[model samples]
Structure formats: C-alpha cells, structure tokens
Target: METHRIEELERKIQEYETIISEMSAPIIPSIVPQTILIPITGLIRAERFDKIRGNVLNFIHNKDIETAIIDLTDISGERIEDVCLEEIGRELHELASSISLMGVKALFVGMNPELVKRMVLDGIKLESQSFSTFQAALKYLMKQKGLEFRKISE
Candidate 1:
C-alpha cells in the first residue's frame, strides 16, 4: 500500500512538472507589420548630418524605407540661431536636391516657427516640396507608392 501511494504521488508530481514547463515556455506571435520609423534627434551638427545623410542614401539605394521623417520640433529654439539656421537651410536644400536626383521622396517633419521664419527669410528653397504631420507624411508616401488611398468625403 505504501509503495502504491508513493508511485501515485510521483505521477502527480510529474504531471505538475509538465504543466509548469509548458506554462514557462515562451509564446511567439505570428504577425508583424513591416513599416520602418526613424526619428531625427538632437541639434543640426555635422555628425548628425552625416549619419542622416548616410542612412537616407542607403535607404534610397536599397529601396527599403518608404518615408524618412526629419523632425525639427525637438530642436532647441536657441539652436535655430542664425548660424545653425543657415546650416539647416543649406542642408535641407541639398537634401531636397539629392532626393530629386535620386528620384526618391523625403518627407520633413515638425517644422517649428523659428525654422519656418528662417526658411522664409533665408529663402531656403523647399517651397516646391511636400511636407506634413507624421501621419500625413506616411499617407502621402503610401499614396506615392501606388497604394490605395482611402478617400475622405466632404
């Protein structure tokens, strides 16, 4: 009788161990979206410019990224000083020209008031371009890529 009780207890323990092991196993999910999002961070320094320029060119070359958002809202208002603003204007103009040359689309994001003023005063020359909020930029890129646009009715 004692031997039978010990065997029954061991069987129960083995069942519990199996259950615990199954519960501890990691659960892998199936579906994931393929959109890539890159954030532009920090001041408009040359290093930052180089990194961004390299990434942009690579993405353009590989045809992986559909849209690149160059957010400017996080930039310090003081950083938009005359010198930095001039640098930004030149970089943006060059970026736009580069994208045009490569036949790729670049969507700039987060245009602060100071940057806008500087662009106007300095004549940065991004006038004949398209830019918008992050969501709008994504939608525009999708539309440009021949994806179906969900029409909005008036």
Candidate 2:
C-alpha cells in the first residue's frame, strides 16, 4: 500500500510538470489573420525546446497559420545564458526550416544583436524572414495582405 501511494504521487508530480512546461511557451494568435506569435522566454533547455517545437507544430497543424513569429527577446535567464549561443541559433534555424517545410512562413523576431552577429561570424544563415520587432513583422505581413490599421480617438 505504501509503495502504491508513493508511485501515485510521483505520477501526479510528472503530470504537473508537463502542464507547467506547456504553459511556459504559449502560441498566441496575432492580430493579422493566419499569423501566430510564440514568445520564447526564460531558461531554454533541450526538453523545453522539444515542448515548444511540439506544441507549435501541433497548433499549426490544427489551425490555418500562414506565419509563425518566434520572438526570442525574453530568452535571457541564468541557466539559458550559460548555454552556447551557437547551439541555440542552430536549433532555431532548424526549427524554422521545419516550419517552412510545412508550408508556413516562419518569421523570427527580437533576436539579440550579439547572437545575430555570432551567427553571422559562424556563417550560419537563417532561412526565415527576420525582423527586429514583432510589430514590424506584423506590419509587413498585413501590408502583404493589403490590410492597414487606423488609429481611433476615444
């Protein structure tokens, strides 16, 4: 009886961890139609990246997302900072390519300048459309669709 209780507790703990991991990287819909924005933040481990990739791919497959904006501006944590920038860049590039193969345009935004410089130095070419900000990417996408936003006064 004691062993069974312990196993049940462990199983519950694993379930909670999976839920937290899923909550960490959320795929939000953008104002532009068929565009989804995924803001990646905090410590990025191999496991976390896997969760993000899986969730994004599942979301895209279910929805008619034409563009995916992967914003990495908030990817700054003590644990993540220790990881090699080159490795992260390579993984991101690979993810973009995978998304492209699925017929969705991947737009990487908010990349750190230092990281970008490192990628350039390492001769790692990004295959997706990159922008300095999410707004810029959204604006460009909206323009392509002949859509414009007008400011309204209260």
Candidate 3:
C-alpha cells in the first residue's frame, strides 16, 4: 500500500516537471501581427532546446506566423560547456532550417559575445538573421510591416 502511494506521487511529480519544462520555452505572439517570439531562459541545456524546437515548430505550423524571434539573452558562455554548445548550435541551425522550410523566417536576438566567440572557435557557423537585442529584432519586424517608432510629446 505504501509503495502504491509513493508511485502515485512520483507520477504526479513527473507531470509537474513536464509542465514546468513546457512553460520554460513559450512561443509568444508579438504585438505585430504574424510574428512570435521564443524567449529562452535558464541554464543552457540540450533538453531545453529540444523543447523549444518542438514547441516553435508546432506552434508555427498551425498558426499564420511570418517571423519567429528566438531570444537567447539568458545563455552565457561561462555556464555552458563545449559539448552542450555544439549540440545547441547544431539544433539552432536545424531549427532555423526547419522553420524556413515551413515558409516562416526565424530571427535570433540577444546572443552574447562570449557564446558567439566559443561557437566560432568550435567552427559552428550558424547562418540566419540575428539581432543584438529583442528591440532590434522587433524593429526589423515592425519595419517589415511598414511600422516605425517615433518620439511622442509627453
């Protein structure tokens, strides 16, 4: 009887973990139409990237999204190892390619210099549109939609 109780608790724990992991990577629709952003947070892990890839692809598949901004501000060079970097880089490239094949453009934002340096040293060249910040990416998207930000009198 005690074993059965423990097993049920384990199952519930696993379910909660799955939910939390799913929440960690969300595809957020932008203020502009047909645009979405995926803000990647927390430690750089292949598992998290896997979830992001699946979620982005699936969400864009059914939706009429034209652009996807992948925010990488939370990843740092010091926190991730070479092997993990390689996997994440490869997956990122593949995810872009997949999104392209689906007729959606993918953009990267907030890539730290250290991570880029490590990727370059590792010979991982990921090709695609990348911005230094979310605002930059959003600016580009807005321009594409024929919108611009102007200073307004207070």
Against the hidden reference, what TM-scores do the models get?
0.58, 0.89, 0.88
Question: lDDT of all the models against the reference?
Answer: 0.57, 0.84, 0.81
lDDT (tens digit, per residue) of candidate 2 on 1-154: 9999999999999999888887778889899999999998767776677778878888888578899999987865354754677778888988898888778999999887777877898888888889989889988999999999999999
Identify the leading candidate in terms of lDDT.
2
Greater lDDT among 1 and 2 belongs to 2
* Ranking of all predicted structures according to TM-score, beginning with the best and ending with the worst: 2, 3, 1
Question: Which runs in model 2 stand beyond 4 Å of their true positions?
Answer: 77-82, 152-154
Error of 3 at 149 (Å): 4.0
The C-alpha RMSD in Å for every predicted model, in order, reads: 16.0, 1.9, 2.2
Tell me the tens digit of each residue's lDDT in model 1 across 78-130: 65434477677777777656655666545566677777788789877773244
* lDDT, residue 87, model 1: 73
Residue-pair clashes per prediction, in order, are 0, 0, 0
